[model samples]
Structures are given as structure tokens and as C-alpha cells.
Target: MVHETAAPASELVLEPFELSDDFYQRPHDAYDLLRARGAAHFVRFPDGGTGWLVTDYEAAKAVFLDPAVSKALKSPGAQAALGGDAGGAAMFGDMMLFYDPPEHTRLRALVNRAFSGRAVRELAPRITELADGLLAGLAEDAATEQDLLDRYAFPLPMLVICELLGVPNEDRDSFRAWSTTLVSNDETPEARGAAVSQFLGYIDGLIRAKQEAPADDLLSELISASEDGDRLSHRELISMVFLLLIAGFETTVNLISNAVAILLTDNGVRAALAADPGRMADFVEEALRFESPAGEGTFRYTTAPVTVGGIEIPAGQRVLVSMAAADRDPSRFDDPHRVDLDRADKNHLAFGYGVHRCVGAPLARMEGGVALTRLLAAYPDLVLATDTELSWRKSLIVRGLTALPVRLRP
Candidate 1:
């Protein structure tokens, strides 16, 4: 039987989170208010779900380590709180993000083999080549001052992930639209469901094709495992592929875009990276902390009563760890707002912590480093286009710029 709990009297309630408008422009300001109030603030999320938002670094880490916390989708009150037909679970529920040990452990182990460091290392050269190819197109559009997100940042990761999953490049545009809608806070649940259905159907077809004629790709390897050991069901296979493909490049798109914006705006960082191009990795780390690409970690619900930052949260309630806010916790990071490439402690929760940490982190880091290094080398005088206005993506989970117009030459 499913167990649940009632809310305690000490629960701190606040207004619904403002993900659009002001919050999109300056999310830190809102995060600052929440952090100042306490380590954790109970807020009605944009989806109308009331949950605890952990803002401080220590608190965030504690929540990650707490055994009482769970990734199970059957949270007692979460569905009603989120209103009818919550679409997030349909997309992310069957994946690793919403599973616990034994199930999570089994799935992680199988996928981990394909994402091993050696595999990522082998792909680095191809990623660098891909970046150069994308840069060539950007150079062609130099005179027009194109949007960086559209011209390079968005397509590069999308292409790489498509190639990695052995999916046809021709279908890129369709999945790109699907990805945008899935993570978008602006889309309605019904709309999001349509996108999910289409994406899963496509993936289902891809998996079946791989099963019949195995190839030298990750999908083939997974299909092999499924056929050999009956280790995976159809839903698990589709969900795993979905998680990898979406989580694989979506965050990297934002990371690379954020790096370009940061490097151009801050000459000091640009000069530092220019002097020692090897520090491109460090630059990516700082960007992860300073302006986290993934604004927040996936949701976790408490199986038992737990206290975070002295606020008592009862069992069965949802919890959200703000990775963006935690990375900038003044207590953990010095000059938290500043982007410093030389900082000794580059530890950031951008990829998350513990068991639920991103499986594609190594690929993300390599992609960011290669993209930054090549982008800077290709366009020595790259700077944001003053004529165009910059806009941030209106998303609570993923934080990034919608458009970053830039000139190729100084």
C-alpha cells in the first residue's frame, strides 16, 4: 500500500514562484529573497504545487544525502498540488531521475558502460570537429550578426546527441521542437503531452530498428542487453533513451551559450582563457557555478519527516533543490556572483550530487571546453550585438538565453 504524511504546523508558505517576467530576467534576485528568508522556503510552484525549495548549499547537499528523500512519482499530494494531468512525469518519470536504489542502480549500471570516460574521450575529437563545422556556418553569416543560439550553440549539441544515439540527422528539427516544449514552463500540460507522445513514438521506432539490425552505437548496445538478458522492458528502454538524449544535450546547449555570453561580457575571463586556453575547462566550471545552466535539480519527495535549514517538512511532501542558488551560496563560494576561472574550489552542484548526478556530465564538460576554445579562436573579436536585445529562456528547470546576437569581427 502507498504511504503518506500530513504537513507540519511549521511549514513556511509563500506565493507561487514567478518563473516568467521578472524572475526570468533576474532569477538571482528572487533566489536571494528566498535564501535570506531561510535555507528552505515553502512556495507554491508555477505549476501550483506547494513544495520546499532549498536555496543554501549545505541544505541542498543534505537533501541529496537524506535517505528519507525519494524520486518516486507517486507523491501523495503532488498530483493535486500540480493540478490535473501533470506532464513532467510523463516525460521524466520512467527515467532515472524518478527512481530509487535497486531499480536506479540497475539502470545506471547498464547505461554507465556506454558513457564511460573512455567513450567520451574517444568522442572529443569528433565534438571538436563538429564545433569547427558549426563555426564555419557562423563565419558565413558574419555580416548579418546572427543569433548564436540558433546558428551554433543549439544545433551543435543537437547534432552531436543525434549522432551519439544513432538517430537520423534529418529528424533533428522535429526533436528540437519537442525538446523545447518538454522543458518549457510556458507550455500547457496538454501541449507537453503531445510532444512527449510524438518523441516516444519516434524513439520506439528507433529502438525496434536497432533491435533488428544492431549497429555500432549506444542504442544498439542497449538493445543487445535487452534482447540477451531481458534486462529492460520496452517502457524502460524508451524512457532511458529519452533521458539520455534530452538530458544529454539540452543542458550542454545552455552551458555553451552561457559560456559565450560570459566570455564576451567579461574581458578579464576572455583574456585569462586566451592566455591559457587550457583553462577552458575551468571557465566551464565557473560558468556552471556563476550562472548554472540547469537552474534546479530534479524533484525529490520525502518518505519521512525531515528538517532542512531548521524548517520541518513532513513526509510525502515534495522538495526541490535549487542547484543555481546553492552554487551561489555566499557561505560556500567567495564572491559568489563573480565568475572566476582561477578559483581553487570549483566544486559546483550544476551536474547535481550523489546517485542522481547527471550521467552525461563528462560529455557536457568536453563539449563546453571544445566549444569555448574553438569559438574564441575562430572569432577573436566576437562580441554581443548591441543592436539586438538579449533574452533569457523562460524556464524553471533549464536556464539559458533564447537569443544572443553577436558580431564575428571586432
Candidate 2:
């Protein structure tokens, strides 16, 4: 194993183990040093597993598009390598994101119809209604600052997904709690296992209900499709529901929250956007590029030897493509650090590239666009709440603010 001495004061111990702290808390100075060293480097997992961290834009894209490098699930001993616990098993087995082609293609194709632009467009009216309702709740407390996340950002996406999936409105709280536990970084092995089991139980119940009496919801469609042998297996169906519940809500939640946070912090951008509602699309793209929710792409394992950024990755090794770093690559983007709403080359890897691109991109874009436009229009004087550090989520795979406190304009 290659052992480079840990950079001065680096949180990563330069051993074959996981980094000490979550990537979000790591000092910017450390990131700068690593960036300067190269876009990709070897990092040790806490379990003594070695993995590659790809930070450069070209290298990240290459790793993402290259079929030679398999997603972590495809790797032998992948379960043990990725914590070998119930959570790991659940992630690899049920999520299409972890699977490679053929299976990935089939699963993604089955769900793609439901998330198509036409289908998502049909929900725009409802999405707007939901956004307005959430905003209405915030309006009552306009005099005092509110946590945008709790008041608006979080619920909007969750509600939309639940409604789409035909999850009963009364069961929303239970769904939220179960989802929170499954995704929470604070949960222990036993706790996570229990949460996973409970979540699966909930999905099983929901699926059985859908099977008995179909509805016009997405889950109903998935159930029908699977039953007709046009889609997934029993296990796959449960996994897809779980995946949709998590992905359907989580990514959009961060996107909307992050966009508002950026706009509130930057007066010029906010004023510019507020002046023209038509610029909402471009502004959303900039937000995705500047502060992507998924900091890194899904993990992949080398099915065969592959060279990335001039470094040779041996077979059976894990690799991570840093979406955050790629979106900021100066080579592809001029003045990479600045948020340019008008930047013509916004072809960022934020949604990823190649076959595994995010299936919910259109819906995410619509939700974010509508949320920001309505937000800026309604609260022309929205400003950040004072004395809040804007705690970020701890997951290295997903990047987002935990809470965004803001004073809605009267």
C-alpha cells in the first residue's frame, strides 16, 4: 500500500483507513492542499480498506463514464468492503444507483417513464400549490425568522414524493421519521439495522396495499408494471420504493435549500434574479454547479485495471468521483469558484454523466426553479437569520445545509 505522510494537520491519517472527520468539517486549507497535490488520491477507510478519491473534472467524468470500472456493488467482497452490515446490504441490493448496466438499465427504464418530462410537467400545478401552502405556513410567522429547511425546503420535496407515491398524508410523519433514521449518520449498526427493517416493513405494507387496489400514483404504476413482468422482482420492487423515497426527496431538498441559502447570502444575485423570473432556470443551474447536493458521485469499484488522472487503479479497488470538485474544475469552467448565472458552459457533472445520470433531473429542476422564483417574488427582502452557522449534513456522498434560517419579508 502506498503511504504518503499525512499533510500537516490533515484530518486524514494517511493510513489504510477512513478519514477521521466527515469531509464537510475538514478545513478548507486541507482541501486546498489535496487539490494542489492532484485531483485523485488514496484514502484509508476506517475499516482499513483503501480507496481512490477522484477530484479533477476530467478524471471524475472518465471514472463515471468508463464501463471498465464497475460500481461498488459489482465488486467481489463489496459487502465486507463497505461495512458489511445491514445498511450496506440494503444499499447495494436494493438501489439501482449501485448496480451496473443491464440490471441498472432495466430498473432505471421502468421508473423513467414515471419521471419523464411529460409526467413531471403534469405535476407542476400541484408542486406549485404545495410550495404555496408551505410558504403560507411561513407567512404566519413572517415577523420572526424561520428555519427555511423545516418551514419550506424539507416538507415540499417530501410531500411531493409522498403524494406521487400515494403515501397517505396521515402517514407522512411516520415516513419522514423512518427515512430520517435510515439516512441519519448518527445511527449505530443496530439502530440502522432496525431502521432498515422498519422501513422495509413499511414498504412491504404499502406495496401489498397497492397490489390489492391500484391507484393513479407512481407506486401503483410500478406495482402494475412489475406484476406484468415488464419491470422488477419482489425484492427489486421493495428496493425501488425505498430508493425512490430517499432519492425522490433528499436531493431536491438540498437543492432548494442550498439555492435559497446562496441567494440570501449574495445580494447581487438575488436582486438580479428577482428582477427577472425568466432567469430562474439559469440560476438553478448555477446553484447545481456551484453547490451541488451530491458532493461525490456514487462509489465504484474497478472491475479491471484502469488509469485515472495518470494513476493506475488496480482491479477490485474502490473509486469515488467528486462531483463538487468536478463542478469547480477551472479547466471546464472559467472562474470556477464564482457563481455565474449566465455562464454558457454549465454542462456540469452535478447530475452526473453517461448511463447512470440522475433520473430525477427534470423533476428536480422544476421543483428548484419554482421554489426559487416564488420565494424571491414573495419575499423580496429575504435575508439570512443571524448567529446561525448553517450546519451541514455529515454524509460525504451527499452535501447540503441542515438548516437555513431566514427572515421572510413582510
RMSD of each: 4.7, 3.7
- How accurate locally is residue 97 in candidate 1, as Cα lDDT from 0 to 100? 71
Candidate 1 has what TM-score?
0.91
Q: How close is candidate 2 to the true structure, as a TM-score?
A: 0.90
Per-candidate TM equals 0.91, 0.90
Q: Which candidate is the best by TM-score?
A: 1
State the C-alpha lDDT per candidate. 0.80, 0.75
Name the best candidate (by lDDT).
Answer: 1
Model 1 CA lDDT for position 43: 67
lDDT for residue 132 in candidate 2, whole number 0-100: 85
lDDT of 1 by residue, 232-251 (tens): 67788899998888888889
Poorest 10 consecutive residues of model 1 by lDDT?
Answer: 1-10
- Stretches off by above 4 angstroms in model 1 are 1-20, 46-48, 75-92, 117-119, 226-230, 387-389
lDDT of 1: 0.80
Can you write out model 2's per-residue Cα lDDT over 1-410, one digit (the tens) per residue?
22355455454424332355444654233344456667677776323446887777888888888988776464563543354432375444767877888878888878876555343558889998998888877787887878888878888888899888888877767767776666655656687677788888889899999889988888887766641367677788888888888888888888999898888778878878868878899999999998887777457777677887766776666787878877887777898778888899978888888888888888889888888777776788788877656778766567778788888973
Candidate 1: clashing pairs of residues:
none
